[model samples]
Target chain A: MYTSLFYKEWIKTRRPLLLLSAVFAATVAYILLNVAKLYQANPVALWEFIVQNNAAQAGYLKYLTLGAGIALALVQLAPEMQNKRLKLTLHLPLNESKIVGSILWFGIVALTGLYLASGAILLAGLTVYFPAEIVSANLLAMLPWMLGGLAAYLFAAWICLEPVWRQRVLYTIPALGCTSLFYLDALPGAYLPFVPWLASLTVAGFAFPFYSAIRFKQGVQ
Target chain B: MNAIIQCENITHYYGNRLIYENLNFEVMPGKILGLLGKNGTGKTTIINILTGFLKPRAGVCRIFGEAMERLTPAAKSRIGLLLEGHIQHTYFNIEQIEKFYSRFFPKWKREAYYELLKRLQVTSTQKISAMSCGQRSQVALGLLFAQDPDLLILDDFSMGLDPGYRRLFVEYLREYITAENKTVFLTSHIIQDMEQLIDDCIIMDYGRILLHEPAAHILNHFRRFRFTSDADEIAPADGTLWHTEKVGNNWETYSFASAADVQRTLADGGAAVSGLAEERLSLEDAFIGLTGKY
Candidate 1:
């Protein structure tokens, strides 16, 4: 039954998933090509640039990482919500949480795998670019960013279903609040990289599969 | 025979309006139990409650003698439900669904699915998104019967089906009930389609079980009664009777429970009780007679 569920997921999700995988491969290749072009042209200047802008570079990567999470939520989970096909799985004999969880986790794994493959290619290009550049062992040692993208997507999907049009305003409230806190410089340092909305998405990435699963088990009338 | 499905006083409320109140009924095993009501009479609500889809506001329902909320996998495995519309993922083709369902339903017979597919004219390779409404309905039925459940619950049956498919469906349903002798709990406003197959019926109107009995018994007892003058209007059993409007100058009252009791009441009311006969009732007529207010 579990395999069947996963198979169903693969059949339904294959197109978007394939397109994303292709995107991952292409983007990584381009990044590697750019790194090689700069390294061979001016090795001294490229090494100095890396040392000077390491934080900015990491920040940019973090932003890109966040984008990955966002894409995972929308691309993988949103369509199911909009189409209302989740009800079909919900009505089935399987546990609601388990089914949704499996789907969410499945997307997470796929996104992570494709992204890591791209990153590895990019890292090889970086190694060829400037061998003498100071590589931060500590920053590299930090844990992989938890892509709670699937979770957020599921949460947003759940919120999106409410019949009330005013419920949409709920999105703006969080966005505005987050901006105000960031402007005030009150944002905590440890959680700086993982934005609240992203965190919610990540949380949704984890929690929604279970919660939605329970709701799914309730079945459709 | 033991009741395989029991609805123990299930009362549901939609905002301020009550749908069904203290609706008590039980469907015996291997019996075709039909639920008959007019549109919006809460038949679907009752069905949703039975399948554990929509939660009841007041009481619990039991399937195969166990509470539906606590339904075991083995219990759910034995019951098949086909809702009003097709419930499969449309993105998937018929072959994919057939393959997927083969894993989920333990009793799912692949040979039986294909057999029904052939008989029903459903192609396994047809995508659900591309199939016409009639074809989709067929696929749903095919999946349902393929599971070989002990209890089959069908809601709003014959909606999208063309005449040919309708005939085929009825024939198959009739055969299943008679040969396998499984319990069928079906609800539809189109009562005549399923009326012939039903041994028992549970009905609702104005948020109460207006009638619940064997189809023959309800037909035999609780008929249209004609009475002349105000002096002839007899009190019915605790106000359970319905008044069916005028025929010439006399008033007609339809009362349920016991014909003998109703006959005695008319006799005691000091009026002419000359017209006493069973009205040749269609399921439609019985529906209006019990539920309609004149």
Candidate 2:
């Protein structure tokens, strides 16, 4: 059952997913090439700037990943809400909760995979010249952003599955607040201390979609 | 035969406005029960409740002897629903939707779905969103048949279809219902389409069931009688007379029993009647008379 659902979601998301991946790869390559150019022009100055100034060249990834995650969730869920096709989905023979969980899980898997791939691209590009510790620090700084991406997907699911506009606006208040927490500061390794708690909170947000589904079933709108 | 779908004292409200109150009915096994009502009479609300999409404020609905709100997955598997306007997962192509649904139903009839699809202009790769409303309706109908459900609840199957498509839909449904002998509960404003299709009907008005009877019985027994009477004369308090209206000097009464029964009712009420002739009515006329305009 989940296999079929995954295939269904894959069909819906394959185009956007490929496009996003291409864009991520291109962006990483561009950033790496620019860094390389700077290094070749003035290697000593670049090294001093990086070491003394704590320049986070990879900071662009924070919002980029979050945007990708939000777009991905919208691509997956907006149609279901717009035309009320979720009603057809909920009528299927599977347990309603299981059906919802499966769809959300598929979106999570795809979003998480894309985030990880983007991270790998950035890591590989930076590791060519940067020291191992700098590369590791840059990657660690991305933790909150990665967590933000997942939370954006979950919150988008919550917002889209929500039937009433008034309640959706109310939900957005907290959703915006939650998403903003990940971008507090781009300092390298700043989010490391809160990593465990942030991850726990992101995982717990999955339950919000189920609550929306229940309200939808009850004809809340 | 036992009841397959039953609702007792099903009352519901949306905010301060009551949608329906103390509504009650049942669809017996192997019966096609058509729910007829004017717009805003809570037909769709009842459908939503029956499908477990809405919880009524006051009553219980049972399908296959299990409460609707608590229907198990196994129970849901036995019911097929064609949603209003033939809503579906419009992103998927025909082949994709077939594969997705076939996995859920153990008795999925792939051939049945494909056979129905063959009659349409849609190709296997066509997305449902790309198709016209008529073609989409066909796809929705095909998927419902493929599920092989024991009880089919069609909520306004003829909503957007042209007359040709509506006739085709009813014909195909007739053939399937005869072959499978499954129970059906449906709602439609197109009374003519249902005239030849439904076995029993429940007509609703103002949150109450106005009439419930076999189609043949309703046609044979329910009659419209027109006669000249005093403007101030009131209609008889007869339970069999569903409605009465005064137009000019002519009084028209919609009776649920027979012509003689209505005459006896008028005489008993002591209202002097003249030219008490029965008027022939089609199902649509009867529906309008029973529910009234506006």
Task: Find the candidate with the highest lDDT and give its number.
Answer: 2
Q: Model 1, B1-294: lDDT tens per residue?
A: 678988888888877788888888888888888887777778877887887766788888999887876666677778877777555577778788888877878778877667677754556677888887777777877787788888998887777777777777778778877888788998765677777678888777768887788888776665666555544334543564575455677767676645566666666644446555444467666777787743
Model 2, span B1-294: residue lDDT tens: 679999999999988888888988888899999999988888999999998889899999999998988788898899998988989888899999999899989899999999999999878999988998899888999998999999999999999999888988999998999899989999998999999789998999877898898888878766788987774765667676766778876888887666777777887888777788897778888887778766
Candidate 2 regions off by >4 Å? A48-53, B230-233, B267-270
- Model 1 lDDT tens row, A1-221: 78887887778668867776676666656655555665778867665755555511222233344455456555555545543445456556676556666776676676667656655555554555444232232134111332332333444444443323454466436534432332222212344564565455455435534543344445322
List the TM-score for candidate 2's chain B: 0.93
DockQ, every prediction: 0.38, 0.77
TM-scores for every predicted model: 0.79, 0.96
Proportion of native contacts in model 1? 0.46
Evaluate model 1: give its TM-score: 0.79
